[model samples]
Target: MEMVQMLRENATLLKLGYQFELPGPRMAATGILTRNQDQQRQKRMQERKAEEVVEQKSATSSNQEVPTRKIAEMVKHQEVCNKAQIRKPKTKKLKNGANEKESEDILKDLRNNLKPSVKSRHEASNLPPPQRSGRDDLMAAIRGSSIFSLKRVNLT
Candidate 1:
């Protein structure tokens, strides 16, 4: 009775039709509350802090900046030099137009020959005859016997 009274005292009354939430282990557990605006603001502040850190690092090493800049320029210049030095051999244009046409025609003929011919639906449905078993032979013999014959003969 005391525990029930304590629970009733700690319970929160909801606005919707006398619904109450009793304070227990489950009720005490807090869930994550998501606020998009707050999260976005925090993300922006983190990015700004990162940018400031990069700026401060660059500002601190003035002597190192010159060598780094020179190295980047040298890398770009070397890439350009390498691209200019290595020339791809230009493809020679075929002079014989007749030979090109002949080769294309030969390829078309070979491709057509390599392709399999499709069978018609009627031919595809043609199945092999079913193999007879001992049970089938027994059934046929019983049907042919005179004792179990289903035929009726009329006599005048």
Candidate 2:
């Protein structure tokens, strides 16, 4: 047929490094060319493996073992401590009227304890300011742009 001849011509052109545009739909009503039965068997085997993995996970979750060593260690530590002496020490109750006076005394002690450093403000400020150049600006611009953008493209 003419269609078959055209297909053969296209194949020859393609082999010779020439591009050819085929016209219309060239589909045939024939069955698939790849008739390998091994692929189906492999797919079924993979499904069975996945099912086994799921079964194993479910089995592990249902039959989880408690750590007996950790439980025993906790029990042993509890037995060593005396419950009566382990109770938290009671804080001395502060009288409502004396609380304000006590707080003022604490603040006074804190303010008296703080000592001013020997360094003068002018001495700290005497350090030179950092220098900026055009190179820094160029580097920042390069970092902001994508590396892929640096690639050269030919329009022709």
Candidate 3:
């Protein structure tokens, strides 16, 4: 009686309609709650097993339809290709026309300078070529055979 009075003092248990029943033949009715919980758990397990078996059957059926599946994949690929844009390849022209005159003059001067020296093997020496300052003006002066022309020749 004291335990029942103590339990009844709890506002939460009273709100949830909890009954403080004594241990006796009356307690046999509580076995229904345990049986209900077990039944719900068993139902959920059977549902999960059924779902897995259904998925396995669908997978096996899809494998059997392999030819149709390939045709569907090819159709999807064609749709993707059609949605994309086809572009023309880019091309560039290589022209050396502008420097033709300058190159020809340089070639003529180099030929004139090398020919006479090649004929006379006594002029050949194992000395390094002379370095030049003021690159543009000096290179033009040497090519034109102007001032300091012999000292400024470009060696190969």
Candidate 4:
């Protein structure tokens, strides 16, 4: 009976040892997985570096130096000089015009005609009184529309 029990125990120990044995192919599979993970990490780093380069280029392009005040003043002076040169012919044409007195009279008449009309004190005193409300004004406008609404036909 003791020998049989010892034999059974030895069989159980052997089975446990077999179950714990590492498979040869599994080690190679794990090595492939680690290499793939390393490749993925390297790819991500390269993409990040490329993005940084693009960002740096754009930042540099946007940061141009502004022109100084002296340069702006020089440009303005050149423009004024150019405009003065262009207007010299117009000044000569004005000097060559005929009948200056007649032109002056016409200009005076035009100025007088374009002046705004002013109400005299007596005329303002004779004006009609203001209406009491918006409704009264609207009614007045409606009553005054008959002349505008009249229709006329050509006889010829």
lDDT of 2 by residue, 80-135 (tens): 66564568587666667567679889889888677555566677778797687899
For all candidates in order, the CA lDDT equals 0.63, 0.61, 0.64, 0.65
Summarize candidate 1's per-residue lDDT along 36-139 as a digit string, tens digits.
Answer: 33456688999999999999898888756576778989999999988877875665455565577777788899998887656655576687778999999999
Count: clashes, candidate 1: 0
Kindly report the root-mean-square deviation of model 1 from the true structure over all alpha carbons. Answer: 13.5
Report the poorest 10 consecutive residues by lDDT, candidate 4: 11-20
Worst 10-residue lDDT window for candidate 3 reads 7-16
As a whole number from 0 to 100, the lDDT of residue 86 in candidate 2 is 68
| lDDT-superior candidate, 1 or 3 | 3
How well does model 4 score by local distance difference test? 0.65
Which of the two, 1 or 3, has more TM-score? 3
Off by over 4 Å in 3: 1-16, 67-156
How far in Å is the alpha carbon of 50 misplaced in model 2?
0.5
Candidate 2 or 4, higher lDDT? 4
- Which parts of model 2 have CA positions greater than 4 angstroms off? 1-35, 65-156
